[model samples]
Target: MSSTATKTKPSTNPKKKKKQQQKSAAKKSSAGDATGDSKQKRLATDPPLECSKSDFDSLLVDASGLADYGEASSELIDCARYGEVDAVRAILDVWSPGKSKDGDLPLESGQPARIVDAADASGSTPLHKACANKHSSTARLLLSRGADAHALNDSGNTPLHWAASAGGSDCVGLLLDHADALHSLGRGGRLDVLLKNGFGRSALTEAFASGDTATVQHVLNHDSAEEDRLIGGLDRKDASEGEADEVAEGKSEGAGEKSDDEKGIVHEFDFLRCSEEGEAVDSNERPTVLIRELVSGMKSMRGNDCQGSSASRLYIHLSFSRNPQPIKHADDPFGQAPEDDTTGLGIWCASLVMARWLASPSMVERMAGRRVRELGAGCAIPSLAAAVHGSPAEVIATDLNPETVENIRHNVELNSSTSRAAKLSAATIDWGDESTYPPDPVDYVLCSDCIYQRDIVPLLRKVVSGVLAPGGTFLYVAPDGGRDGLPAFISSMGKNGFERAGGREAPEGYRSNPLRSGDGEDCFLHFHELASTRYVLYEFRKC
Candidate 1:
C-alpha cells in the first residue's frame, strides 16, 4: 500500500498533453497565416510604379465599360507631342516636383506625372519635343511654366537647337529672347550663341544647314543687332565725354589742327598690314605695293633634253594707293575698298598653308574632276595652287572687295597657262547677298583668313551651307590673330553638318618667305612662332 501512494503522483496522461501542445502550435500557425494574408491584400491594393495615361484609361474603361482614349491618352509626353493643352495642364496641376520611391512617379496620378524638365528615355523634355514638333503654343506654355531652355537632350541639343534644326523661326526667336533675358540677369553667359551640341554644332549653324532662309536671317539679324547695340552704346558714351571735355576747354588755338590729326588717326589697326615683306614701314606711310612668293612641294615634268624640276611656287603681285576713297557701292561694305587702299597687306600664312595642303598628292587625287570654290580669296594663292597643281575640274576664286576681286582675276590670268588643266575664274561675290551664290553646288569649299570679324561668322556659315554639296569637302585655314573666335567658327561648321576630318600646323618650307630688308641685300625669313600667330589648317567633310 505505501509503494502505490508514491507512484500515484507519476500518473501518465500522454494523449491529453499531446493534444494540448498540438492546439497551441495550431494557434501560432493560424496567426502567422492571418498576418501574411493581410500583407498580400495591402500589396494588391497598391498602385503600379509607372502608370501611363493609356494604362489608366484602360483601367477606367474596364471598370466603367467606356470607350478607350487610344493614342490620345498616353502620358505627359504624348499630351505635349499632340498639343493637348488642357490635358497637359491637368496633369501638371497635381504633379509634385520630385521623385518617388520607385525612381519615377507613379502612374496612378492621372498621366504618369512628370516635372517640367523631366526627360523621357531619349532624354528629351516636353520643351524639346514641343519645339521639335513645331508646337509653338505648347512650347510657350512649357517655357512659361519654368521648363529649362538650356536642358540638354541625349544628343546634347537644347530646345533652341531643336527649333533651329526644325526651322521654327518663332521658336528660335522666343528661345533667343529668353536667352537674352537670362544673360541680362547674369544667369547665363553671353547667351552661348556658340554653344555646341553632341555633334559640335551651334544653333546658328543648324539653322543654316536646314536651308531655312528666314530662320538663318533671323539668327544673323539677332547677332548683328546685339553687336550694334553694344557698339552704339559705347560710342555714345565716348562721344558724350569728349563733348563735355571740349566744351570745358573752350576754343583752343590748336583746335583745327587737332581735328585734322584726330580724323587722320586710324582707330582700327589691321594686323595683316603691319608685316610687308619683312620691310619696316611707318604706320602713317601707306604701303604702295606688296609682292610674295608662295612655295610648296617639288614639281617635275619630263623634257626632251633634260629633266625639268623646280619648286612649286606662285608669284603674287598686289598694287595699292595711299588715299581714302569712297566705296563704289554703298550697299556693299565688304565690296568697298579699304580706307587707305592698303587692301593687300601681307600674304596670310593661312593662304600658304592651304595651298601646300591642297597640293599634296592625296588631296590632288581627290580634287580630280571636282568643282572647287574659294571664299575670301585675298591673294588667290590657294585657289591658284588648287587649280594649277591639284588638277580640279574647275575653280572659282571669289572676294567681297572689288580690289581683291580684280587682284585675284589678275593672278588667275597670270597663271592661266600653268593651270590649263582646270577651268579657273574670278568673281566679285558678296556673302551678305545670297543672290550672288552659284546656282549649282560646289564639290569643295576653301576658306582662309576670312573669319576675322565676329559679326561675319554667321553669314560665312550660311554661304558655306548654301554652296557646299552633300558629300563635299571644306578646307579652312586660320591664323592665330589674338582673336578667340576660331572655336566658335569651328563649332558653327559642325552644326552645319560639317565634320572635322583633320587639322595641322603650317609646314616650315610652305610658309611665305620673309621679305628682303633695305637694299634687298639683308634677306631674313619671316617665320611665325608656334606660340604666336601660327597657321592652322583644318579639313571638314559635309555629311
Candidate 2:
C-alpha cells in the first residue's frame, strides 16, 4: 500500500505516547555497551507498543505511534493490532496487488518481507503488534506472508520477546514454529532469544517478567521439542516394516522405554524426602543412586552441552565442602536431584535463576548497603552472588542442616575474595525452630526452588516474617507449576501481613540482562540451568 493512498494519520494522544516512549536512564546510558550512541538513541525513542484507538471499537493497537509512516500503513498496523483478519487480508492484497492473482509473495512489489514487516515511527512491525496483542492468527498470517520475526522495534524487542511477555504458550509456540520454518525458507528461521531490549531484557527475561511459568517452560523446551520431532521422523519409516518386525523390535526394546537421552533425570518423586537429619535411608526405599547432571539440566543445564556436547563439568562451589554442593531449600522435589545426596546437596534451577537476578545491576542496587539472608541456602549461590557482586553489608547463607551449613561456610572460604571474607557467613538456621532465628536485622531474604512440599508452607512464611526487618523485601522463587505449594504459600503469606512488594524500594525494572551480568561461565550456566524448568520469581514485603 502506498503511503499517500489513504488520508488517515495517527491520532494518538501525545502525552500517553510520550509516557510509553520513556526509557529508564540505565537503558539510555547503557546503549554504548551494545550499539553506537546516535543509532541507539534514535531506536530508543522508538519503543514498540503504544495504546491507540483503531477504526473499530476502542481496540488498542501498538502502531508505529509515529504518524509519519502515512495513512495506508497506519491502517495496516491498526488491523494487525485489532486482529482484524479480513482487514489485514484486504490490506495485504492491496499492497501486493500482483499476488492476489497467483497467491504468492508480491514478487512484482519487490518482496512481501518489506511490506509485511514495514515499521512505523515506533519501529514496530505488523508482526510485533500482532504478537504483542497475542493475535496468533494474525501473526501466523504475517509469517506466511513474510514478516521478519527478528525485526526489532524502538526498544530492540523482536516479535518473539513480545510474544513471550504476552504470558502464554500459543504466541511463543507460533513464533518458534515459524522460526524453524523460516530458516528453511532462507528467511532466517532462528529467533534470537538472546537479543536484549533497551533494558537488556531478552525473550526469556520477558517470560520471567511476565510471571508466567508456562511460557518459560515452552521456551526452555524449544530445542528439545525439535529433537523429538527429528527422532520421531527417523523412527516412523522404520516402524512400518511389517507387524512382525515391529513386534520383534518392540519386544527387544520393551514398551515405554525412554531414550537414554533421559540425561541424568530419573523419575519424578517426592521432593520431601528424608533429609532433616541428613541420615542415610533404607537402600530399598531411597536407593542411593547418583546420575551425573541428573535430568534437571540433563539436556540444557550445561548450556549447549544439553544439545549434544560433552560434559563441561561446570559445578558451583559453596561452603566448607572444598567440593561443590548443589543449592535448594526443600527436597529437590520438583525433579533433578542428585541420587545419592539429599536435595540440599544438589543445586536447583530456581536457585541459579535467583543468582542471576542477584547479579544484575538493578538487583545489586537493591542489595547494596543492605543485609541479605538466604534461606535453605543449598549451595548458597545467591549468597555467593550477593557477596561477590551485590556489595551488600552482609550475606548469611542458612540452612536447617549443620552439614549444609558447614558446606556453605567452606564454599565461602574457598571463594576467599576480600568481599567474600568480609560479607559472607554460613550458619545453621532451623526452619522448624523459631528460637534459632538470629537477632541481626535482615533487609532482604532470598529463597528459591524449595517450596515444593505442602506442609512446609506455613513455617516458611513464619521464618521469613521473623527474620526480615520492617520494610524488608522477601525474594521467593519456585516452579510456577507441577506443585500445589506456590498458591498456598502466596495465600498464606498474603493473609498474614504480607503484600506483593512493589515501589521505589524494589526493582522498578531490569537495567541489564541479569543472566548475562555476572562471570560469563557462571552466568551462562545459570541462564541455561534456569531454562530447564518453569520456575517463577516473586518479591513481597511485610504489610
Candidate 3:
C-alpha cells in the first residue's frame, strides 16, 4: 500500500481549489487567526494535566473572552459540558480570583463577574451545562470556583431549573444551598427564595415535572437528611457527638410535628395581651452608663462599647437623618424615616439599651464563650458590645435589609482589634424563611425594638423557633408605647413553646426624660428624645 493509494486527499480541480482557497481566505479574514490555536485547551487535551503558568495565563484571557465575544463554545465550557471534572479543575486551578471576566450575571460583582459564571450565546454557562447534563462533580467544581447558581440563560432558566429538570438531585441539592446567593432577590427581597423562570415555573415546579420523588421532597424540604453531609451546618455537630442516630430518628419520625413539651402550656400560665412576666431590676446589677450618655456617644466611638469598659478600641458609622415625618409621640426616639424604615441610619435607644445590658459586667461575663445573635440590630451596637466586651464565641448581627446589614458590617470593620472583629459578623437574615436561619441553632437570640408591628410577630416567632437551641434565651426589647407590637409578641410567644422567664423596665437609671434642653444631646438628633423614653426587656426561654 503506497502513500498515494492510501491517502488521496488533495483536490486537483482548478475551480474547486480556487473556490476552497477563497472560502479559506474568507474564514481567515473572519476568524483573524488561521492557525486554529486553542487556549485553556490544555485542560481538554490528552494528559489533561494543568498547563504551565504562561500557557494558562494566555489561555485564561482567551477562554474568558470567548463567551463575551458571542462564541458558543470555549475550552472551559466544552469541558464542563462533557462532564470533564479534571479538565474543569485544571482550568480553575490556574484561574485567579483577581482575574475577572464579563459574565453579565444579573447582580454581578461591581464591574464584570467571575469567569466561572460567564455565559455563552444561549446564556448558558459552564455551570448551566454541567447541571443541565447532570454532571454533579463538574457542577460542584464550577460552584466552588464562584459559579452563580441563580444565573439565567436565554430562556430565563437558572442552573437550578436545569438541575431539577435533569433529575439531578445531587446537583439540585447543591444549587438549593446557594439558590438565593449572589443577591438573587426577586420582588420579595429574600436570599433563600429562588426566582421563578420567565414561564413562572420555579425549581420546585421543575422537580415535579421531572417526576422524581426524591428531588421533589428535597426541593420541598430544603433541609434534607443529607443536608449536613451535603450543605453542612450546626446539625452536623450532633453526628460527631454520637447523637446522629437519635437526631436522625427524631427528624425522620416527626420532623414537622411538635411533641408534648413543644406544645405550649398556655393553660397553666396566666397571660394577658399587655401583661409582662416580672418587673424587678436588681439595684446591684444596674448599669452605670447613663442612658443620656448613650444618646450622645451613639454616632461615634466614645461611649458605645459599654461606656468604653472593653479594652478593645472600637468605632462605628451612623448618619443622622430627620424623621421622615415627626411623630407626635416622643416614645419612638429613633423612629422610621421616609415613613418606611422604623430604624433608619441613626442609632436607636433600644440598641443602646441592649448594648448597655450586653456591656454590663454580669451580662458580659455570662456571654463569654456563648454564641449570640441580634436581630434588627441597627448599627449592631449590642452585637458589637457582646463581641468586644463579653468576647462571645461569635456574635452575628442580622437584619432583613441589606443596607442595614452593610451598615452592620461597616461598624464591624471600624473596630481596631482583629480578634474582636473576627468574633463579630454581619449577615442578612429573614425572620419568615427557615432556610435563612443560621446552619446551627443559636444559644441566644437578641432583639432590639424589632417587635413594633402585629404583622411581624409571627415571623419573629417563627425565626426564634427555627434558630434557638433547646432552652436558648430570646431577649426582646420594645418600648411600652400604646402600639400593639409588644402586646402581640407577648400574647403569641406564650403559646409557642416558650416560657417567659423574666421582664423588666429598661432599668430606671437607663431612662431619661425627652426634652433635649440643648444639653449633652449631640449624638443623634431625634434619638435624644428616645434615650429617656421607657423600654421594657422581656426574656423568653425555649422549652
Candidate 4:
C-alpha cells in the first residue's frame, strides 16, 4: 500500500491534523520492524472466534478503568471483527474515547492538565491501547485527535512501551520518529527510568535479563549519541589506579559521560566500564544496578581460564546438590526447589551439568571431536562443562548479555588451569551473526530454556538454520509454559523444517534450580530431533 494511503483524512482541526500526519509517517517508518507478513497472515486468518477486541476497545476507552465490565465497548469489537476501515472509523467516532466520562473533549475546552491527562491505570493512552488491539485505523484516528505521546500510566509506561512490549514494533517506531518520546523514564523522572519498573528495575536490565534483544536494542539506540560521549571520555580517562578514585566518584554523579555513536553496538554485551572501586566511570552510566551482571562480572568470581570462576563453579555445585530439600510439587522430576532455601546452587550447577550431558555423548559417537558452538549461553556453564568433558576440538559460548559473556570467559579460565574443566572459549553472539558462526559447520549446538519472546521465533529459526551443519544436531530445552509457548514454537518450527523427536522425560533433578522454570508450574524440556529420533541421543538429545 502507498504510504499516503495509510494516512488519516485531514482533520478540520488544523492542529490535530498536523499531529495525525506526523504520527502517520512515524508508523510507516517503523512498519518494517513489525511482525512482517507471516504475523499479519496469522492474525488475519486465524479463528475469528478466537480473535480479541481488547486491543481495540482499550484504544477507545484508553485501556484503563474498564476492568469492571470484564470488557470494553462491543462496537469497537465489531469494527475489529468486520475488518472494515470505514466501520471502525464510525464506531470510534461514536464510542467514548478515553476514560473521560464526557467523552473526547472539544478542542476549544482548553482544559487544565490534571491526573486525568495521565489517568492511565496501565501505561496505555487511547492511542496505545488501540494499537494494542491491532486496530490500526482507530489508532490513526486517536493520534489525529491529539492524544499525548508523552503521557504515562500508573506503571510509568508510555504507549510506545506497551506497543513495543506487545511486539507492535511498527507502532513503537511510529511514535518514536515523530514525537521523540522518552523511553526510559520512571514515574518521577527520566534518568535510571528503564531500571525502576513497578518495583525498581531498569527496563534495559529487564530486557537483557529476559533475553529481549529487540527491546534492549530499541532503548539503547534511542540514545546512541549519549552512549558515544560516555565511551569517548572513558577512553580519555587516566589509566593509573590513583586516578580511579576521582573518576569513580565523578562517574557516580554522571559527571563526564560521552555521547554514544550511531555506528551501533556490534554486540549486546558491550557496556560502559566502571572504576576499580565499583563506582561509575562515566556520566551516562546509571547508579542503579542489575545484580545478575554484577555477580557474574566480579573478577574474584572468575576462574583462571576466563570462563566462570570457582565461585561460579561452586555456586553451580551447590545449586544442583539436591540439598536443603525441594519445594512444593517437589515430587515432580523437573520441579524447582524453594528459591529462598537454595544457596543459589541448583541453577548454577544445573546449567553446567545439563550442558555436558547434552553435548558429550553425541560428540564421542558422532563427528570425532570437531568444532562446537552454543548460542545465547548465559554464564556458559553448559558450554564450559562440554568443553571439559566433551570431545569437541573447540567450543565457543556466546550470549548478547555482556555480563554473562564476561563470566563465560572467567569460568573458562578457571576450569582450564586449576581444574580439568573445559578449555572453553567465550564471545558475544547475537542470534544470526555469520561471523560468530564458525567457517566450518559445527558438530553440535546446545541451548537451554532460551525461548522466551514470542515474536523472536523467526529470528531464532534463522539462526538455527544458518548455523547448523548438514547433519549438525541442535539441542534445546524449553520450559513448556507461557501464553505463547509450545504452540507458537512448534508451529513456527514446522514451517521452518524442524521436527519434534519424541523425547525422554526431563529428570526431576533438573527442576530444583531457579533458572529452570519453564512456561508455567509444569514446564518440561523436550528433545526434538533434527533428523530421526533414534539417531539423536544424549540425555536430552533427539534419539
State the TM-score for model 1. Answer: 0.37
**lDDT for each residue of candidate 3 in 68-135, tens digit (9 for 90 to 100):** 32232356677777676655664554443443243333233332335576666677788888887777
Query: Which pairs of residues collide in candidate 1?
Result: 51-107, 201-495, 277-515, 514-526
Off by over 4 Å in 4: 1-353, 359-368, 418-423, 512-543
Regions more than 4 Å wrong, model 3: 1-344, 416-422, 512-519, 523-526
lDDT of 2 by residue, 348-448 (tens): 65665566567556788878889888998877767777677557888889886554565566456534443432577888777768788989768998897
Q: Which candidate do you rate higher for lDDT, 1 or 3?
A: 3
Number of the top TM-score candidate: 2
RMSD of 4: 20.1
Predicted candidate 2, C-alpha RMSD: 19.1
TM-scores of all predicted structures: 0.37, 0.43, 0.38, 0.32
- Name the regions of candidate 1 deviating beyond 4 angstroms: 1-346, 512-532
Model 2 misplaced stretches (Cα beyond 4 Å): 1-69, 97-113, 185-187, 211-218, 224-377, 380-406, 415-543
Candidates 2 and 3: which is better by lDDT?
2
